[model samples]
Each structure stands twice: as C-alpha cells, then as structure tokens.
Target: MAIKITGFYQLPHQTMPELVDFDEVFDTSFMRKYTRFRTFEKFLQGSRLKIENQRDFEALPEEKMDAWVRKATKFSSWQEMLDTATDKYVMHKNM
Candidate 1:
C-alpha cells in the first residue's frame, strides 16, 4: 500500500529499482509506465508520450517532469515517493 505523506519532502529513502531510459520508457510499451523509473530521461519519455509530438525529449518541460515520472512509477507521485521512500543506506531496515 502507498502511504500518504503530509510534509517533509524527505521520502522514506527508497531506491529506484526499475530505472530505464527514455527510449524504453515510451517505446510503445505501457509496461514501463507501471515500473519505477527515475531520472529526467524516463520522465521525458512519459511526457513525450502524452504530447505525441516532435518536441525534443531532452528539452521537455521541466515543471511537469516530476508529475510525468510519478505517473510512470508505482508511487502516486514524486511527493509520495519522497514522503514514503525507505532509506537505502540501511539495507537491514527492510530485513
């Protein structure tokens, strides 16, 4: 289940497990959208898919990039991920 964080932009410190490139993120494979992709590359891919134009993925809008990333991943949004993210330094935390 996803947790709803109120404030403190500090996510639970989770790891981006299914990080992928822009090409793969929007390569006619909707599966990528459900994956936990990170970086501006994947975010750009998602945004491109939404716009469906010749716009340079690299130059995609920066404002909504985070939203695009959240839609492609399992988290509700960047804010949610940031709030409920689990720490990586302590691998034993999940153990």
Candidate 2:
C-alpha cells in the first residue's frame, strides 16, 4: 500500500496554510515512536514550549528546539530523525 504524508501549518496572518516538510517525510508510526506524538502540533504540545501557533513556532530558538528534539527522541537532530526513520521503514518494509 502507498501512503501520502502531508501536513500544513497556517500563520494567523496568512490566508493560506503552508506545507510542513518534515511531516511529509515519513509515516505516522515512526513519527509516533520517535516523537511520542501523532502530529507536529501534538509534538509541539508535548515539548511544553508554549508554541500555540505558527508565530510562536517560528519564534522558537533553533538551537533550543534542536536540543529538545535530540533529548526527546535520542537523535542528533530532526534531519537525523527523519533520515533514520525513513531508513528503518524501508528496511522493515523490505523484510
């Protein structure tokens, strides 16, 4: 079966929502396993970082967010998490 992964975030001042790249990178199972949250919105909530909207999300300190992601998921960075998850998913799917 093929799956299409997609997620969007809209800023309060924007008329249209924008695609979130990481959310399109993998399936929900890996997302849930690594982040313990089903969606990015939920992940933000789990972080306890007070990111209630797009502006808040954008306002977050990059280094701090990276550190939190690393600590929460045991990955070096969000890119690493996505890469690892994709790799693992491919390996499992082929088995």
Candidate 3:
C-alpha cells in the first residue's frame, strides 16, 4: 500500500547478508540499549516500530517485527542495530 504510493518498493529491497563476528562480542541484554537512549519512547519516535509495552514488543508477529525493524533503524535488522549500539556504548564508555 504505502510502497505503491512511494513508488520506491525497491527502497527496502536489500538482501540482508548474514551478520557474524560482532554477534559474539555484543551484549544485547533486554533494554540495555534503550536505557542508554535518552528514553525508550524517544527511540520509538525516531523509528516506525510501535508497540504498547514490552509484552507488545515481544508478542509482535515475526514478519511484522522484521518489517518494523527494517523501517525503524539504519541497520537491515535488529541484530545489526544491537551490535552497532553495543560498539557505540563501549566506545563512549571508554572515552
């Protein structure tokens, strides 16, 4: 629907290659990254992902979550976001 309007159905058609290596180094425990953010709501505001609460986020259907992640962050998937956020957190902490 929206894709039809934008005429950019191809805008989000990138094939996400599997991400490795950093998966082992990043710590993605619960809302750790969200906590590091100014606020959880603010994080969502910058993104298209939406849910009423933690349970809502968890209960979101797999396809919907995947699409939300694709729309919500710069990364191709949530895992990439996690890995990048972890790196940023580490770098900022050490600075």
- Could you say which candidate leads in lDDT? 2
> Arrange candidates by lDDT, highest first: which order?
2, 3, 1
Candidate 2 residue-wise lDDT at 32? 77
Would you give me the overall lDDT of model 3?
0.44
lDDT tens digits by residue: candidate 2, 35-64: 667765566667877676666666778777
lDDT of 1 at 43: 44
In order, the Cα lDDT scores of the candidates are 0.40, 0.62, 0.44
CA error at residue 72 for candidate 3, angstroms = 3.8
- Give the higher-lDDT candidate: 1 or 3: 3
Best by TM-score: 2
Report the C-alpha lDDT of model 1 over 1-95, residue by residue, as the tens digit: 11111212222454444332323223333334345544333444445545433343334464565666566667666445433332221232345
Query: What are the root-mean-square deviations of the candidates from the true structure over C-alphas?
Result: 11.6, 9.7, 13.5
Q: Tell me how far the alpha carbon of residue 80 in candidate 3 is from the true structure, in angstroms, after superposition.
A: 0.7
TM-score of each: 0.29, 0.53, 0.43
A best-first ranking of the candidates according to their TM-score comes to 2, 3, 1
Candidate 2 structure lDDT: 0.62
Backbone clashes in model 3, listed as residue pairs: none
